[model samples]
Structures are given as structure tokens and as C-alpha cells.
Target: MNFCKRTDLILVLITAVVTTSILGFALSNQVVAQINGTQQQNQMDYTGFHSNIEQIIAHLEKAEYNKFFNNNTLTLGHALHPIEEVLTLVTIPLSTADSNLNDTYFKDLYQLSALASPGNSTVDEFDNKSKSSIELSNEVVATVIPATVLSTTEHNVSVIKDLLTISGSEYKEGVAGGNIILELEYQDGSAFMDRAYTLFNNTQNISNDTQSVTKLLSDFSNLTDSVQSLKEPAVIDQIIQKMNIGLSPNDNSTTSDVSSSQTSQDYIDTIRGLLNEVITAYESNDKIKAKELTTIAYLDNFEYIEASIGKELSDRGEALLREKLREQIDGNASIDEIKQNIADINKVLDDSAGFLDSNPK
Candidate 1:
């Protein structure tokens, strides 16, 4: 009897140990999965940082155009002032990922800012700083994102078209009768064309036909000189229209509509940022500030793009979100409720983006 009892106890002990080990394995895996999920989210956040950097570069290029054409130092500073703030936002996440990379980025950013100060830095100095900053950003891109997903050729050309269209519009606003009437507007228009030219050259190697690419390059060269001479902006438009036919023979979207797609994206990004601020403010118990931000977001940003948003898709969605956000704020909604509402708003915006991207009108 004693031997049988000892055997039963030993069996029970072994079974318990096995069950505990199995549970431990599952728990460990769960922890690891959670950590991996957080890492992926961090990576996605970095992708957004990369996009914001690209927008800043656009501003920088525009500033460069102003300086190169008319020595407009004021525009140079105004354009670049946003860089520091953007960098400040990314500092913590960047530090968490790689301290060295964060350090290098900020160093380059500060130097660029110093060199770009109005009435201080020459175009050559600013150019060098810009190059360094751009190269550093490229390094960040290589480290953070796979090359295959960097950017598609179609997306590149779409961006090129937007730049070109905006260039034509700006030129029209700045010049009349082969003379620059508005220096600032003309400089902005010329700057956009310069940017488009650079981007077009970069896309050449990926293009299937070398001859057509060369022809486009020659046309761009001629257009550049014509722009300098303050020729009719319609000529620029004509060249862009020809390029568009080659790009999308079936698509009938106007150049302005195509350009509005980009503008719409910009507005959405801004609205998202403001909504984030609203959450932060409300959570901190600053209802007044939160309500004010909510108002500014809709009135200042969304209102401007309201017409451009697809009439069928956004007519109710945006207004509904605007109203719901206000209701949540006024009712003293919980933090989670506010966040959930913001998420819903983001989903609506995403749908709007899809519609705009595909329809482009």
C-alpha cells in the first residue's frame, strides 16, 4: 500500500510539472509577440516621420528656388523654420530606436537651420547644408524601410506632375506679357519647375524607353529657358498636357484636379495633427483649448478642402465627424471615448484619401 501511494504522488508531481512548462512556453511566446507588435508600430511611426521629412524637403527646395532666382532670404528662413519643430517631434522615438542616428539627424538639422537663417547664410552654404541633410535622410530611409517599398514609379510621376502643374499656375500668377509682375509668385513657380526637372531626371533610368525620355528632357530644357524669359504659362501647361497623355491615355482628370489630390492629402495630414493635439489637450483637462483646436481644425483646415473632397463620399462623413468630435468634447467624454472617436475620424479621412487618390477630382 505504501509503495502504491508513493507511485501515485510521483505521477501527480510529474503531470503538474509538465503542465507548468507548457503554460510557461505559451506565456513567453505571447510576451515576445507583444514586443514584436510594438516594434512594428514603431517602424510605422518612423515611416510617417520619413513622409514629413519629404514635405520639409519640398519646402526647402522652394526656398532654394527663391534664393537662387532673386536672393530672397526672407522666404528661405520662413520655409525652413518648420524643420526644427518637426525634428523635435521625432526626437524621442528616434532616440529609442538608435541613439546615434538621432544624434546625426539633429546635428545636420541644426546646422542646416543655422545656415538658412535669413540675411546670414549664402546660397552656397545653404546648399551644402541641404545636401548633407538630404543624404542623412537617405541613410535613415535605407535603414528603416526596404528598398522595394521606397516608392513606385507611378507615384513618382504623379508627384512630378503635381509639381509641374503647380509650377505653371505659379508662373501664371507671377508673370504677364513676358515680364515678371510678381517676383515672389514667379520665384515659387520657377522653384517648383526646378524640382520637377530634378525628379524627372532621376526617373529616367527606370523608364522603358530611352528615346522618349531624352525627348522629354530636351523639352524640359527648352521650357526652363522659356520660363526664365517669362513666356506664356499656357506653353508650360501644353507641355505638361502632352506628358500627361503619354502617362495616362484613358484618364481625363484635369491637371488642377490632379494637383488638388496632393493638396487634399496635405490638408488631411494637417487635420490629423490637430486632432492629435485635441486629444492631448482634452486628456490634460484643458477643455477650452481642446474645443478651440477642434474648431480650428474644421474651420481653418477642413473647410478649405471641403469643396475639393469628393462630393459623394465626404458630404456627410466629414461633417458628422466634426460634429461628433464636438459632442465628445462638450460632454466631457472619457479618454478612451475621445481616442475612439478620433480613430473613427481617421478612418473617414483614409476613405477620403482613397477616393481622392483614385478619382483625383
Candidate 2:
């Protein structure tokens, strides 16, 4: 249920909070009064937006908790929708002068919120708008390259080149082409390199921590075994690749393809639905129906991983035991037996982490 580092997403959110710092800038009483008919209602709306932001935060936290167990994005997106609405409803106070500059971000969020998902287009739009506002200028255009980013990111290269051309400047060493001049920050590479190194190390350490994985597994069911030993090397590599995407600077292949037909959230809902169906079949004493639900929902998902483990009594074995035990429960196995089977599976999963450690990818 781990999510890769979402630096870009977090940046979008963080900037939105203080983006309206211009609201506190010089506002005439007339402008303020014209914007809000009543001072009391204005105060109320301000207070309400604050409360709404908090409520949205609660939604994200709850969604994250669900994701920790289920790895469901649908659940997360469902929660994000409310906050998106709140961001939309927050109108900019009607200050005609400099309002376009001030309201640029609020305007952006209005569109971002309406999207079914703030997919790549919305995210890129927001990023570009936010960046251009702070850095770009029609009068003063220059090519500024960081040593680290120049080696990668073809898009950024085109962007800088376009800025140079638009400025109508010809370059000959320090001689400017029109108004465009190349201004390079020669020492900027150190800070970016340090940040990249730190991110990689921190992510690797967290993913490799046996205790943390075991603790996470413990929460699913109190199966007490060290989890580092049970870790899957391929899975670990997948995780590392996901986490290191932007941070690595040169790792173009870090991104995963969305090949699973169902969205993460949809997949989760299907599993949950099957679990409910299994419960219903068990309650009705329909052994065949219960097995059908369990096999389709859980067993099929694990079948690929089972073969990958390549061991007799590894994670796969424990999973098979749990699946069979669940079927046995439908056929009148005792509750204690069910618990025992789960515990056994937990131990096996935990030990498999060690096997993963020994066999590195």
C-alpha cells in the first residue's frame, strides 16, 4: 500500500495555501465592501474556507489509511473531490487592479477542481502557471540551466531555448542576441545532487527496514514474524524504481505502466465486494459459492506471486494455506483454526522478506 514520493503533487498543494498572499496586499475599503456585501458574511466565508480545508485534510488522512491497507486510489480520489470543490468555491476578492496576476492561481484551481481527476494535463498546467508567474518575464528573457537538469528533461531544454528566441537576443559569449542572454548558475549542481542523494538513501532505507514492513504486516493481522526476511526482491526493486523517479534525475525507466485494467481503487472495490460475497456464501452455508468468491478474488491475484517465490514453504505456501483455511471455514472449520492459519501465513510472509534480502535483484 505504499505510494511513491509525490513531490510534485505536494508542491501543488503547498503553494495553494500561501498563493493568495496578495489578498493581504493593499485593498481599498471600497473594493473590500464591493466584493462582500456584508462584513459578517465575509468573515464567515473566510472561517468556513479554513474549516473546509481542515475537513479536506481529514478526508486525505482517512483515504491514506485505507490505502495503507488496500492500496486503493479510488478511495483516495473520492476523498480529494470534496477538497477540490472547496478550492473551486474560494473566490478571489474583487480587486480589479492587479486581479489577473493575483487571481491567476485561484483561476487555475477553479479548472483543476472541475476535472474528473487532476490528470497530467491539469497538473502540468498548474505547474507551468505557478512557475511562469514567479520566473518568466516578457522584458527580461534568458536561458538559465542547472547543470543537473540539462543532461535530462528534453522538455525543459526546448522551454529554455524558446525563451531565448522570444527575447529576440543574439548570443556571442557575453554579447546579447537582442535582449536574450544566457545566464548559467555554475554551482547549482551541488545542491541538486545532494538532494537527489539524500532522497535515494532515505527511500532505500525505509523500504529495506524489516521491522517497518513487519509492523505494517502486523496491522493487517497480528501474525508475528520478522518481515525483512519475507521481503520479495523483485517487489523491492519495483518499489525503489517507483520512489526514485524524479529524484534519480537520469532514471527514465522508473515509471510503471498502468497495465492492470482496473484502477487501483476499482480493483480494491472488486476485492471488497468479493469478500462480502464470500461472507454471504459462508453465512448461507454455500460452500461452493464461498470458494468461488475466495478463489477469484484472492487466489488468482496471488497465483503469479506464488510461482515467483519459487520455494515450497515461502510466502506462496502460507498464502495457499490461508486460502485453503478460508475455504475450510466456509465448510465449518472453527474460528480458532482460521486465526491459526492467518498467523501461519503472516510468519511465512515475514520470513519471505529474508529470502528476498538474500536474493537481491
The most accurate candidate by TM-score is 1
- Candidates' TM-scores? 0.48, 0.22
After aligning candidate 1 to the native by TM-score, how far in Å is the CA of 22 from where it should be?
43
Q: How many angstroms is residue 42 displaced in model 2 relative to the true structure, after the best TM-score fit?
A: 42
lDDT by residue (tens digit), candidate 2, 290-340: 444444444223322333344464345534443354446434666455446
lDDT of 1 by residue, 1-361 (tens): 0001112343344334323322232111111110101112313443334433443465566666556665555344424333322343344344445657866775565555555545557878777667666777667655644466556665556556656765676576667788877665576567667766776776644367777676777778887888887788777677766765545445577444544345777778877887888888787775644655665566435644554564554555554455577656656679899898888778878887887788785
What lDDT does each candidate get?
0.57, 0.33
Model 1 lDDT, full chain set: 0.57
In candidate 1, position 63 carries an lDDT of 60
Among these predicted structures, which one has the highest lDDT? 1
Which segments of model 1 are wrong by more than 4 Å?
1-75, 78-107, 118-127, 140-145, 169-173, 176-182, 204-206, 232-235, 249-257, 260-361
